[model samples]
Target: MFAIAVRFDLHDTAAAERFDELVALTVPGIRAEEPGTLVYTPHQVRDEPLARLFYEVYRDEQAHAAHEARPATAAFLEQVRGLTRQLRVELLADLPS
Candidate 1:
């Protein structure tokens, strides 16, 4: 599977919540629209409340590319433009399950 691991540091706790709200909307839309999206999970760090993590798994590079091209993704990016910092994204190769 092709995966992406993402981490974000929000400007504040409030921004984290706002960003999560944006994700809530985006994730469901992706699930409904993209059959190749296998997993899309968002997590909040317990030790650092302002930190957000996302684990996304797709069928292949094409699936991942399709996800990035979605309108929901675009809207989500626009929504969080100023709410985050120290954002990191890692493209991963999943081990055999």
Candidate 2:
């Protein structure tokens, strides 16, 4: 398995709304529609209103790449571009189970 982790900071006031939108709308759609997506989880830090994290898992690198190429992902990115502040993405190798 491969993992894709992303961390970002959003505007404090928009944090809750953004997290809600992602969980209620974005995450479900991605998990159901993207075949390569094994898992998609988004989280927000309780103490830091602006902090957000995304933990995604896929079968492999090819699967991960395909997920990134999906139209829904593109649309989501476009929709959230303005809502996010600082973004950082990291590709990781999953440890043996």
Candidate 3:
């Protein structure tokens, strides 16, 4: 599996609101259309009202590439750039079990 975590520091309350709206619009597509998207979850940050985080897992690198290739994913990335003051993306590596 391939995993990634994204942190969004939204510009303000308005940006956060817009970001949430975008998420609502975008996730349904991800859920319905993305078979290789094993898990995709968004979270509101504790004590940071303007912060949002996303956890995403894919079946493999090809799956992740397919997700990125989607038009909705492109649109989501474009819209979120305006809302976010800072965006941090981490490519996660698994630890030995």
Q: Give the per-residue Cα lDDT of candidate 3 at 24.
A: 96
* lDDT by residue (tens digit), candidate 2, 1-97: 7898898778667665875575578788787787878888888777887788889898888998888788877887777777778889998875789
Clashes of 2: 0
Which RMSD does model 2 reach against the true structure?
2.1
Instruction: State the lDDT of candidate 3 residue by residue for 1-66, as single tens digits.
Output: 999999999999999999999999999889889999999999999999999999999999999999
Provide the global lDDT of candidate 3 against the true structure.
Answer: 0.96
Q: Across residues 8-70, which tens digit of lDDT does each residue of candidate 1 receive?
A: 999987898899888877788888899999998889878999998899999998999999998
Q: Which numbered prediction scores highest in TM-score against the true structure?
A: 3
lDDT, model 2, position 8? 71
Candidate 2 has what TM-score?
0.83
Ten contiguous residues minimizing lDDT sum, candidate 2:
14-23
Better of 1 and 2 by lDDT: 1
The runs of at least 3 residues in candidate 3 whose Cα sits more than 4 Å from the true structure, single-residue gaps closed, are: none
Model 1's TM-score against the true structure = 0.91
The residue pairs in collision within model 3 are: none
The list of candidate 1 runs beyond 4 A from truth reads: 95-97
